[model samples]
Target: MKKTYLLLTALIVFSYTAIAQAVPAAAKMNQFIDQLMQKMTLDEKIGQLNLLTPGGGIPTGAVVSTDVEAKIKNGQVGGLFGVIGAEKVLQAQRLAVEKSRLHIPLIFGSDVIHGHKTTFPIPLGLACSWDTILIKQTARAAAEEATADGLSWAFSPMVDICRDPRWGRIAEGAGEDPFLGSAIAAAMVRGYQSNNLRQDNTVMACVKHFALYGAAEGGRDYNTVDMSRIRMYNDYLPPYKAAIDAGAGSVMSSFNVIDDIPATGNRWLLTDLLRNQWNFNGFVVSDYTSVNEMEAHGLGNLQQVSALALKAGLDMDMVGEGFLTTLKKSLQEGKITMRDINNACRRVLEAKYKLGLFENPYRNVSTERAATTILSPDKLALSRKAAAKACVLLKNDKTILPLQHTGTIALVGPLADSRRNMLGTWSVSGDWHHAVTLKEGMENVAGQQVKIVYAKGANISDDSLFNKKVNVFGPEIEMGPATSDVMIQEAVAAALQADVVVAALGEAADMSGESSSRADIGLPESPQRLLTALVHTG
Candidate 1:
């Protein structure tokens, strides 16, 4: 009994020592942020809650903020995405630290979803390997490249658990199981941020579309999601909690309603659950214009919804001027307290502080460093290995996959040589020109001993309206000058000349990402007809 008492006393002492050792770093961060916030004006404090994007990269929303340079100089911006390259990032950072009144360093971010410049398989594909280590490595590689290009934050590891394949964004997450989703979420956070946010090669991971976005009614993007609290806790919320617990620096609120309230304005969710219950210390940012989107959700006008979001614990507004335009008015109107605004601003500043931005704002912004680091040979090799591991062989009929290099092979489809679709979805920073298509890969692997005949079997879809919708980001689906019938004939002619036919068919990249849910998730009519023609030719 005496020994037990001594052991327990020793354990308590050790725990106290560990806590004592850890508190100073955190206390220092708090102290620094407190001092910085004191120097900021009301407009500057409000500006720290606004996240905007310049029009250089893909705009997920309709509006990209104009006068971005002016905003940064005026201290009306917190962070910027859509801007790539180290030189460009350095220029933006200079505007904030050199020109802004408080000279708070700006945090640059991007959607480094799967892999950065060195693109890998989509998240869903990576999840299929069920190898968390490999998944983590992919994220680590992405962080390395992203940081080299001067990005400090990655909006990644979309952990939404989706059972419905019709939901286009399912490709962006681990598949239907919450257990797997939770595991992958933790791995991703660890990979991106690791044990240190101050590390030059690390990036702050943002676990996104928080709280049951995958449960949208009818599998529609940004649609209503109605579910009981028990169901949400059991099926949908575990992955988010896992990410937060794993040290994700930020969370992005989903554009869905919980308990009939938009998530951006749900205090019970962002605060009561994420903060008080889960003990998540990170900040929360809304999805693209999600704060303003709440107005469309019938909550209120832009000003009212922005106020509700701030009071509910949303730290930063993404590409929406709601918080930038209306938070001051709300504070003046007594709709929200000054403490609320300060809390959000402090959280944003804390992220920058943790990133060691105050010590050296130019930590990752070096063109010389970027030239050697982004898409390095080792990273490209890792991407190749990841892609191979992610390939799921649904079936092997007659052991045909291990094809002989001596045979004439027919590689026929719109996707056969399509580089644009190779990287899949949400790969904003990936250059499709750098992507290796199936034909190119086959020729390289099969060598000159094999004669490879290729044909564009069909346009991805013959439906003009469907093509138009998928082509929003660019021409993912290009209706060729040749008719569908002519395309099928060409594919059949190629197939007849080959010993074996390899038909590559699937949805366009845009057909399976944000705002792209499909009611009938199947092969498009054009691909279906081409497949039929090829089979009938036998």
Candidate 2:
């Protein structure tokens, strides 16, 4: 009987030890989050939400803050996006792991939409092909390049389904089909999070503009999203839900109000629907300054919006500082519980752990590894291949494109020989200097047989009102002094001289990000006017 008692006691001790760090990966995940949170302070909890700008902000210029270095050492930043390249990420990450109190590793993220070094077709245009395998391949390339850059996350596969082309960010997603969107969403998730989240070559994919930003009123950014529960379930929610089901590592809330409430504060949307209904295990992050914008939406002060967002199941705040500033006061005031804070912190830590940041601290980030993968000769070759593949034969009338190699091709317009504008919106991480512009591309294809003439046919648009909105992001668009007729005559004369007038044109980059949206989706009136003149003169 004494021997039996001794055995039972030993079994109990063994059981408790095993339960503390249980086997099976999912159970171990819970244990790891619990252990990490036990060591964290209230300050560190706030730090998780404070996604401070590492490079660029709304005024459209990048700020290389001297403070970012010190802040990371102090455990003030949870993660970073926008800042690319392996060296930058490694420097920032080292400060976090080597200098912070807890020594928690930082997760590096970027807008690796489509492809990273090898630029694929824009998401919207690519989706038109309806080939899931191609989309997956595009995502795979993005993952490879992103991981090569010391990144473990991508703000990509923006799965929002846009019904209207009028929405500027429509270029960033699949168009208007919930069924197709869901499939592509899963494909993207699989591609980005290949093998596992902890793999060095895999990066977490973020399914973004969540809970119906795409269906914004009149397709305008910052507009309201009003749809019945049934409508959402049947149409809008499927792709995001599909992304969650496919194990997407994170989600980004949109900049729109849902029903009568701002999405940043909607518990039914984020918590009940996303967490409880769909069973999403990953973290939820807000759009840029979206939580702060809730104040403008008449949702009370910053504290009130912050409380609302936290209660609604948002895990991280992006650029708002809403969660960073107000959660502690709310906790003291009996507004939010400790359980709430723990849940949020748990989600964020889970992501970092799954990225293998805690294990090796520099797993995918060797300088040599980054050099071998990023913009390698093969990757550049793939970029040209992707560019060629993405150049859709939109209007191949009389075989306009695949232009005759021997003919003189006139690449007329702002984008003709330009390097910067070849990339569309959100190309900050891309090496625009390397892009072969329309004229350059034409020249390369034609060899010395074709002469390419170029001109800025008209500034993005001649209308001053439209020009103002377009120019808000950058100084790229200049309001030309020439009258509409003068601009047209110039383009017409140039076009009439060449065998084929390749009028290089489109919305300039930065017209489709966040709040930089346009009401009119047509070609800028200046370009339209030029095209008309060119046809009439011929």
Kindly list the per-residue Cα lDDT of model 1 for residues 162-228, writing each as its tens digit: 8788888999999899999999999999999988889999999999888899998888888889998
Any runs in candidate 1 off by more than 4 Å, and if so which? 1-17
Per-residue lDDT of model 2, residues 216-281, tens digit only = 888887677888888888988899988999989899888787887888789988988888988888
lDDT of all the models against the reference?
0.91, 0.78
The candidate that achieves the highest TM-score relative to the unseen native structure:
1
- Report lDDT (Cα) of residue 431, candidate 2: 62
Best by lDDT: 1
The clash number for model 1 is: 0
Error of 2 at 411 (Å): 3.4
Clashing residue pairs in candidate 2 are: none
RMSD of 1: 2.1
* Per-candidate TM-score against the hidden true structure: 0.96, 0.88
